[model samples]
Target chain A: MSSQSFNRLTPYLFMAPAAIIMAIALFYPLLYMVFGSFRSWDPSQSLSETEFVGLANYIKLLGDEAFRESVSVTLTFAGTVVVAEMFIGVGLALMLDRNIRGMSLLRTLFILPMMIAPVVVGLVWRFMYHPTDGIFNRWLTQLGLPRVDWLGDHALMSVIIADIWQWTPFIFILSLAALQSLPRSALEAARIDGATGWQQIIHIKLPLMAPVLIVTCLLRLIDAFKVLEVILVMTEGGPGLSTEILALRISRTAQEFRELGEAAAMSNYLLLLLMVLTLGMFTFTRWQEARAQQLNKVKQEEG
Target chain B: MPKIRLDGLVKRYGAVEVLHNIDLTMEENEFTVLVGPSGCGKSTTLRMLAGLDIVSEGEIYMDDRPISRLEPKDRDLAMVFQDYALYPHMNVARNMSFALRLQKRPKEEIDLKVREVAKILGLTEYLNRKPGELSGGQRQRVAMGRALTRDAGTFLFDEPLSNLDAKLRGQMRAELALMRQRVQKNMVYVTHDQVEAMTLADRIVVMHGGYIQQQGTPEELFKRPVNKFVAGFLGSPPMNFMDVTLEETGEKFFARGDGFRIALPGRLADRARRVGQSELTMGIRPSDLNFDAAAPDSEAMDLRVSISEYIGAQSVLICKCGEATVTVEVKSETPIALGETLRFAVRPEGIQLFDKKTEDAL
Candidate 1:
């Protein structure tokens, strides 16, 4: 090969090892799961012994009531945690944006929940929600309020609260960063333009932070959908599928029911949902970049 | 328009004081320009006037009302920032009408006011375009239009034209001057560019090291600068300073220095004598020095031309006068060449003297 061609091939040669490893470690299983979804495969059976049952597993999942309930539960958990976290996170960020003596320390504390191990967070929250011995119920009893069932009838609510506790700080730090990076002069201009503190936040602060906030929200939403460990440790999808999110349901379908093909199909459904959300975020950022580039082109042309 | 006053104003950030006691009063509808170098407390004073910065030790009064404690909105003022701090998300029309809209004014009134200001600024065609889409000059106009739409009693401009390119700055400056004529408001502008201060201000306040050096009309400050700093700062190709001994020979007073000696005019000599200082600094503007080889020795200085900077119509000749470098402005057509000694006649009326010890005007 010529020198230029050799130089071009050098990068590919360096990338070949990682590419092969990815194909073996990532794509092999993905393709295997997709292939197995079309067959009546069991964990004990070899791939060659499985019988081809094209569309059967997908059709079964489509008609399954438990599957539909799990999908709805997943949606509710992701939606509730994301929306609640966004509001509370953005509110806290705005309140803490100013300078105080211990503001940096306070911000570090605010992000501590996200830094902790997810399983540990779940275990701690589980203990906190322990029906009678939990701190929450103990405080309620002391306050003359009725001791409520935290992980029983309100299992979904309890798991959601736990997830929110672990994830709200993720949104908080991102929102705080966005708030701090906003153009200071614009806020000062708003002040001189007679905008009240609330007005400045509404007109200047929030609008400027929209792009970062949108990306942060979408990222959190994607993560929330794939959340398994926290809920698994906290409620274990307890009280008859009340908090059986799709991830937990998929694991149960493969492990407890031993329906490997059905579990693969369920995983594909989750993957499809996450793929759409990822595409949405990708398009949003691309659109913003394109608009900015076009604006620069226009500015240059005028100049 | 109400008269504005900053009485004994001071600013401190923790233990470090950036602005000392500043007292200034602007008459109704007067254009006041605070001209200074960087970090000279000019912008700080303007921010204080706009209530953007707190008055650390003094009060700002408008028409006898102490407005230091009130919010910027209650102070009834509009400000144009250096970066043309137009809302990036808002279009020209929205940016211009934001103040009025915040006040919840009638929609028709806001629209009418925005349209009027846009037409004045020549931003009517770009009203729907966001700041990002517009060029820097257009963004500057949008900032100006934002302030104009407020119709506030006072307008504070903090280096509004500094962000634009050279040509755009000149064009915007002319537009600003024209706008000033059309709009009768208390306008306080801050700039480090002396040309802008000279052209736009009814009263120019020259500041240095957190202190006001001098404040007067543009011509007054130019013709009679109170000290060495103001004299050197206000003019282009700035005033040349030469150390000279004030020698009295018989009836006339002469300023004798190395490589040149010039007779002092009667008025300047009397002032120098009254100050009772023999060692003095003489100031002569480049514009006051004419290229005249035939001029008498007592009225002319022999300057050795070192370099010539051609800047259209006129060229500035950098010359050597003893150990000091002096700049002389002359017509480009003038026959001058490097390495040649030339005599430049000093205008008698243009001579200024400062006490060498105090650096204050004599």
Candidate 2:
């Protein structure tokens, strides 16, 4: 080969290892799962022995009451946890954005929850939700109040609360970063223009932080949808499938029900939902960059 | 219009004091300019007057009413910032009308006021555009429009034209001077440029190191600077200082220094004789030195021209008299050659004497 052809081939040679690993580790499983989702495959049978029954697994899930319940539970958990975390987390960031003494220590402590392993957080929260021996119930009993079942009757709510506690620091840190980066002069201008404290937040701070807040909320939503370890440790799809999200349902379908095709179909559904969210985040950043480019072009023309 | 007064206004950040007690009074509808180098506490005083910074001591009054404790909005003043802090998200009209909207003014009144101010600033065509979409000069116009819509009793400008290029700065300066005639308000402007202070101010306050060095009309400050600092700071080429000793020669007094001795004006001879200082510093402006080959050796200094900076119309020659360097400005058309020694006569009245140790005008 010519030296010019060799030079052009060097970049592709470097990318070959990553591409081969991606095909084997990522695309192989994805392709196998997607292709198997349209077949009638049993755990006892090899993949070559199974017959391809097009769309049968998906159609069966459409009518299955248990699968529908899992879908609804996953939606409720993801939606509720994301919204609740966003509000509480951004509010906490706003309240803590000042320069009081010991504020750096307090900020570090606030973000410590996000740094913990998900399994550890779940185990810690599970102990806290224990009916009789937990700190919360013990305090309730000492205060002359009836002990409420945390992980039994209100299982989904308990999982949602645990998710919020574990992930709110994610939103808080991002929101604080956005708030700190806002233009100081613009806020000063707003203050001199007669904006009160609340008015400044509403008119200046929130509007300026909107782009970061949107991306943060979407990232939290994506993480919330894939949550499994915390819910698995806390409830294990307990008390009649009340807190069984799609991840739990997929695991249970393949392990307990011995239906690999149905489990594969469920995973594809979750993937589709998350793809839309990821696309939304990418589009937002691209649009922001394009707008900035347009502004730069206009400025250049003026100059 | 109300007269503004700063009675012993001081600023301190924690234990570090930035401004000493500043006492200044501005008459109604007067244009008071604060001119100083960076970190001279001029901006601190202006921010204190705007209520952006708390006055650590003393009080500010407007028409005999104490206003130091009031909020910036309550002070009823408008300000144009150096960076032109227009809201990026809002259109020009909305940015200009923000204060009126906060006050809950009638929609028609707010619209009328925004349009009127926009028209005055030549921003009517671009009122619908956001600040991000406009050029810097356009954004600056929007900032001016926002301040103009307020109709406040006082206007404060913190070096508003310093962000522009030289041509734009000069253009905006003329527009500012034109606006000053139409807007009858008490204006306090802060800038490091003495040209802006001289051309725009009804009264100029020259400050240095947290102290007001001198305050007066442009001509008064230019002709009679209180000390050496003001003399060197206010001019383009700056006043030159040379070491000289006071010598009594017959009926006249001469400031004799390195290569030359020039007689002092008759009025200042007795004051020079009484001081009896063997060493003193003499100040002369570049424009005061004239090329006069016919002048007597006693009154003229033989200067060897080293470099001549030709700046159209006039050329400033960098010349030396023995070890002392002096500058002379003459018509550019004059025949001049580098490395040629020429005798330049110094006018007696142009000589300013200062104490060598104190640097105070004598």
Best by DockQ: 1
Misplaced by over 4 Å in model 2 are B273-276
Over the stretch B175-194, how does candidate 1's per-residue lDDT look in tens digits?
A: 99999999999999999999
TM-score of chain A of 2: 0.97
Model 1's DockQ? 0.81
Best prediction by TM-score: 1
Give the lDDT of residue B256 in candidate 1.
96
Please provide, for model 1 over A13-82, each residue's C-alpha lDDT reduced to its tens digit, 9 standing for 90 to 100.
9999999999999999999989989999899999879999999999999999999999999999999999
* lDDT of residue A93 for candidate 1: 94
**Interface RMSD (Å) of model 1?**
0.9
